[model samples]
Target: MKFQDLNTAEERIQLMEKLSETFLSRAGKNDEEGLFPFENIKELKESGYTSLTVPKRYGGKEISLSEFLCLQEKIAEGDGSTALSIGWHMGIIKSLGEKNNWEESVFKDLCEEVKKGALMNNCATEPQTGSPTRGGKPVTSARKEEGFWIINGRKSFTTMAPVLDYFNVSAVIEDSGEIGNFLIPRNSQGLEIDETWDSIAMRGTGSHDLFLKNVRVKEEALVELFQPGKKGAAGWLLHIPACYLGIAQAAQTYAINFAKDYSPNSISGAIIDLPNVQQKIGEMELELMRTRHFLYSVAKKWDEANDETRSMMQPELGAVKLAVTNAALTVVDLAMRVAGARSLSAKNPLQRYYRDVRAGLHNPPMDDMTIQALAKSAIK
Candidate 1:
C-alpha cells in the first residue's frame, strides 16, 4: 500500500517495523562516540521518511498522529537519539500544517525543503531563561528594521543543529512587543552552533546551543501562532512521548532477548524459565502495551480532531507524555534489574537506554508543571 494508504494502525506498525531494520545500523556508532548521525539522516532522506508529515498540497503524505508515533518508535527502537532528533523536525512540519495560518508562502517554502529531504528544527529553550514553564524569561529579542528583523540571544538544546537546513526560532518580537517564531536558514551569517551537548543521556541527539547575534531574517519569516502562551503550544509536546515510547520498546526487545539467552547458574535452564523473571517480563510488557495504547489514542484523536478538539487535548497529551516517558524510565530500570550487573556493562543496551530515556524528564512542558496545569484546570 502507498504511504498515504496506511490509515490503519496495523499497516502503520508494519511500515515502521520495516523502517526500524535500517535505522539502527549507523545510529549505534553515532550514539556511542557522541558523533552526529549524518549517514542515518541521509538514509532517512533517501527513504522518503523525512517528509512523512508534509501536507499533500506540497506533494507529500500527511500521516495521522498514531502513524507518526509508530514510525517514531520504530526509528527510536533502532536509535533513540536519532528518532528523537527527527521527531522534533516532523513535529514542527506537521504542526505548521495542523492549523490554517495565513503563512502559506512560508509553509510552501518549508514543504519545498521537505521535498529535498531538508530538515527544520525548533529553536526554543535557552540559558538563564529556563523552560517556558512559569511564562517567563524570553531573553532572545527580535528587532524589526527596514524589510527584515534581527534576532539576538542564545538558544540551547537546538536539536539537529549540525545539518538543520532551516530553523524555526522563538524570540521576543520587537515591533509587536510579543513572542513569535521566525524561520531562519542554517547558514544565515551570524548564527553559530556551540557543541555544548555533552551529557549523560541523549548525547547523540546533537542538541547543541545556538548563539545568534544580529542574525537578520525576512519580515515574512515571522510566524506567530496565536500568541505563544494562549496559542496552546502542546502540539510540540508530543515529541517527548514519541521518543520515550521508542526507548521503552527498545528496552522491551532487549530484555526479551536477554531473558531467552541468559542462564543464571542457579536457575534450571534459562532466565525466562524463572517465575520471577517471567513476572518481570510480564510487567514490562504491560507497561509497554499501556503506554503504546495511550500514545496512539492521543495521536489518533489529534489526527481526527478539529482545531478546538486538538487544543483541548493538551491535558490528555501531557498526561501521555508524562506517563509514557516515566514508564520508559521504569521499564529500562526493570530491564537492568532483570539483567543484573550485566545491564551496566558498556556493551549492554540498557545503560544507553536508561540514560536516553531519562532525558524525557527534562524535555518540554515538564512533568511537574504539566500535572500542575492539569490540576489547575481541574480546580477551575
Candidate 2:
C-alpha cells in the first residue's frame, strides 16, 4: 500500500478508498467515546499516506493541490475528525515545500522527519487572544536568553496534540514586540499537553491545550516572523472545505440508502419514490455538484499558478472555503430532512455528520470574515 508504489491516480485513490472503508467502521465507537483515532492514523502512516505531501526532492510524492484535496475529501467521507486532524499535517507539509520560507537546512530536516512518518501542526489559537486569523497576537511569550529562546504560555486548539511529533507555535517576542513562529519538538523540556479539548463536535481531533513553561530551544527554532492575519494567500487552507464536503457526501449516501430500504404502510413503495424525498435528494446532489466544481476549479488554478499569480489569490481562496463549507452545511441539512427523525438517533451516522459539518463553520477563515473580505475586494 505504499503511495510510491502506486503508478496512477486511480491506483492511489483505490488505496485511500480501501483505507477509508476501514476507518468508517471504527468511526462510531471513536465518536461515542470522544477518543482519538490513533489506530486510523497508524494505518495511514503504515500505508505511506502520511508522507505523500513531502517534496519529491525529499523522497516523497509531493502531490498537486487538486489531488491532495481529492484524497482529503475521501478520508473525510470515512471520518471528518480523522480527515481534519491529518489534513493540517498534509497541508502544512505541502505549504512548506512550496514556500521554502524556513531556512533550507531546517526545512530539510523537517522534511526528512515527515518522510519518516512524523506529524506536526501549527499551534496559534489561544483562550485569551482567540483565533490567529482575527489578527490576535498570541499571549504566549518568547524571549531570547543566552543565545536560546525561552517560551512560556498556553495555546488552545492544539489539534492532534497527543500524536504530533512537532508543534509550530506562535508567540510574541518579548524583546522586539513582534510575533514569531517557533518550531518546538514534542519531547522538549517543560512542554506538556493539558488534555482540555471537550468540543461536542470533531471530538476525535484531540485539540487539547498546549502548555509551555520555560521551554528553551536554540535560535534556529525561530522559523518565521510575521503579523497575524496578514500572511500571504494560503491555498493549503482549502483542505478545510474538502473535509466538510466529504461529510456531506457521507450524509447524502446514508439518507439515500435509508430512503430506498424503509417503506411505510401508507406508501406502495419505498420512501425514496415519494416526491418530497426525491426533491430533497435532488437538492443535496445539486449542492454537492456546485461545491465540488467551486472547490476543484480553484484548486486547479492554484496548482497551475506561478508564485506571483498565487500571491494575489487570497480573496479567491477565502471565497472557495466560504462557498464550499456553507454548501456542505446545506447538503447535510437536506440529507437530514430526507431522513426525518431517524437522522437524530445517536446510533445513526447522520447525527455525527450533522455535528461534524457544523464544526466547519468555526474553522479558520470564519464566514463573517470571509464575507467582509469579499465586500472589501468588490469595493476595491
Candidate 3:
C-alpha cells in the first residue's frame, strides 16, 4: 500500500507493521547466510515506503521526523539489517529535501527516481581514511576531463550496494583541492562492488566495498561540497539509534516471552516471578521507555525547529544518538541476562539481536565523538 494512501500516521505505521512481519520471518535465514535482503527491499519499494521521505512538493508523504524514526524502529524490530540498510536511503532523502543543497532540477530528478524505487546511499568511508566523521580527506580523487568529471577511488562500508541504483561518492577535487560529492549512477562505466563485507554484526546489510576505476559523470553530477566532519546538525542520523532501539525492543519481547513460559523443577512458577529476573525485565522496560522518550522528543523538536534553530542542535542530536544507542546495548544485555545462556545459542534470535545492536556503536556519531561534541558545546 502507498504510504500516501494512508491518511494518518497510525495507518502508515500499521502498514509498516504488516510489512515488517514478513521481513521478520526471513531475517534469520538472511542473517545466517549473510545474504542481502533484496526481497525485503523490493517489498518496501513496492509498498512506497522508500519514497515517503521525499518532499511533499515532490508528491511524497514527507512524514515528520518523529514518524520517520518510529517507522524505522518498527522496521528494525522485524530485521535490523534491513532497517539499517534502508535507513540510509530514507534519511538521505529527508536530509536532502530539508537542506535543498543540490541543484533543484537534479534533486527533483533524483526524487522522481526514488518514487520509482531507485535507491542511493553515500559512500565516503575508505580503508586509509577510516570513518568519514574523523575529518580524514578522501583518497578518492575527482579530476575534470572535458565536459565530464573522472572519479577514481575505493569506498568501504557502502551499505546496500547489491541493489543501489545510485552511489553518492565523496571525492577530493584534484584541480580545486576540495571535497565534493558526486552522484554516480549504478550503470557508470567503471563502477563496481567488491562484495567484501564480512562483519559478524549486521551481516545482511551488504555493506561491501565500492570501486570506481575512472568512472565518468557529467560535471553537473557534483552534488555537494563540504569539509569532512563539519556538516551541520543532522537529525536524520536518528535512524541509527532508532534501529538499535528496535532491536533492543525485539530482545525485550523475546526475553519476556521466554521468562513467562520457562518454569523449572526448582521453582513453583515461571522464572519471571523470581526477583532477579523481574529486576532485569524492569530495568529493560525502564531503559526502553527512557530512550524512546529521548529519541522521539528530539525528533519532534527537529520537526518543529527552523533552519537556524536546527543548525545549533548538534549537541542535542548527538546526545540522543549516544544515549539511545548505549541504552539499547544495555537493554539487550539485560534481556540476554533474563534468557541466560540460551540467549547465545546460534539458533536464538537474541544472539542475532545482540550482535546487531552492537553495530550501532560503530555507526556515525560515535560515542567518544558525541561526548566530545557535548563537551565542546557546553564549554562554548
Candidate 4:
C-alpha cells in the first residue's frame, strides 16, 4: 500500500512509535559493533517512514515540516545515525515537490515508488572536494554519448549507499559547464560500495565510498544542479538544522537522566542534589529549550511562507544550525562532566554523543562563513 492510502498522521505516528522504540533499544549495540543498522532501515522500509515526505499530488502523504521535524527528533532520540541517514530523503523529496520540477510522467513514476516507500540519497560529497559549499567543482564528469550521458568519478561518505534504491549523484556536464544531478539506480554497472566507515561516532551510518566507472544514464534523469538562492532544488540550509536540533535534544535528555540517577560518591545524595551539578543541568536545559523553540518556530513559519522570504530565511536557518549544534556539543560535554570519570568509559552514551554532535559544527556553510554572512547582512 502507498503512503496516501494510509489516510492520516495518526496511523503513521503509531507506526513510528513502534519501530522507533525497537530501534532505540538496539542502536547502542549496533553502534558499538559497527553495524549499519540495516535492521532499522528494514523496519523503516516496512513502515511508511520511508515515504513520509513525498508530496500528496502523486499518491504521497504531504506532511508539514513541523511534523517532519518532530519525526526526525523522535527517531534521533532513539538513534542519531538512523535519523541523520534518512534525512537526505525527507528534505530532498519534499523540496523537490515544492519546486514541481520533473516532467509529470517522471514525477508520477518516482512518486509512485516513493509512495510505496523507496529511499533516495544525496550522493554529493566527493573525495577531491569536501562539500559543494566550496563550489561543486565535481571531480566527476559526465559526457554525452550515444543517447545517454556516461558518468565517472569517486564519491566518499555516500551515506545509505547500501539500502538506497536511487541516488541523486552530481557530476559536471562537460562543454556546457553545467553541474547536474543524475539519478543512478543502485547496483548499476560499475557502481560499488567501499565499506570504509570506521568512524568514532555515528557508526551505524553506512557512509562509504562510491566508485562510479563509466556509468551511463538517460538525459531526462539528470537533475539540474541548483545554485544557492534558487527557486527549485532542496535548500541545504533548511535540512542541516533538523539534524543539529535532534542531536541537541538527545544530549539534553541523556544529561538529565544521568544526573538524576548518578550518586557520585563524593556528593551526599544523588548528583542531582549538588548545587553545581544542578546549575550545569539548568544551563543544559536552557540551551536545549532555546534551540527547540527557535527550530520549531522556523519550521512552522516556513510551512506557511513563500520564496520571497528567502533572504530572511538564510540568517534564521544559519542561526539555528549554529545554536543547536553547539548546544548539543556543550550539553554532551556537561553530561560527561556531571558523570565524571564514568563518562569516558567506552560503555557510556555521553562519550559517543559528544564526538558525534561536534561534527555538526564543521558540516558546511561553516559557522564562520555563516557568521560572516549574517554580519554582512546585518548592516544592510
lDDT of 3 by residue, 211-285 (tens): 999999998999999999898899999999999999999999999999999998999989989999999999999
What lDDT tens digits, residue by residue, belong to model 4 across residues 175-287? 78777788888867888889988877678788888888998888787866655223222243455666666666666677778888877588777878888888888888888
TM-score of each: 0.93, 0.99, 0.99, 0.92
lDDT per model, in order? 0.80, 0.93, 0.95, 0.75
Q: Specify the highest-lDDT model's number.
A: 3
Q: Write down the lDDT that model 1 would get.
A: 0.80
List the lowest-lDDT window of 10 residues for candidate 2.
Answer: 1-10
Candidate 1: 10-residue stretch with minimal lDDT: 225-234
Clashing pairs in 3: none
Error of 3 at 305 (Å): 0.4
Model 2 residue runs over 4 Å out of place are none
Q: Candidate 2: TM-score?
A: 0.99
Q: Deviation in angstroms for 312 in model 2? A: 1.2
The clash count for each model shown is 0, 0, 0, 0
For candidate 3, the lDDT comes to 0.95
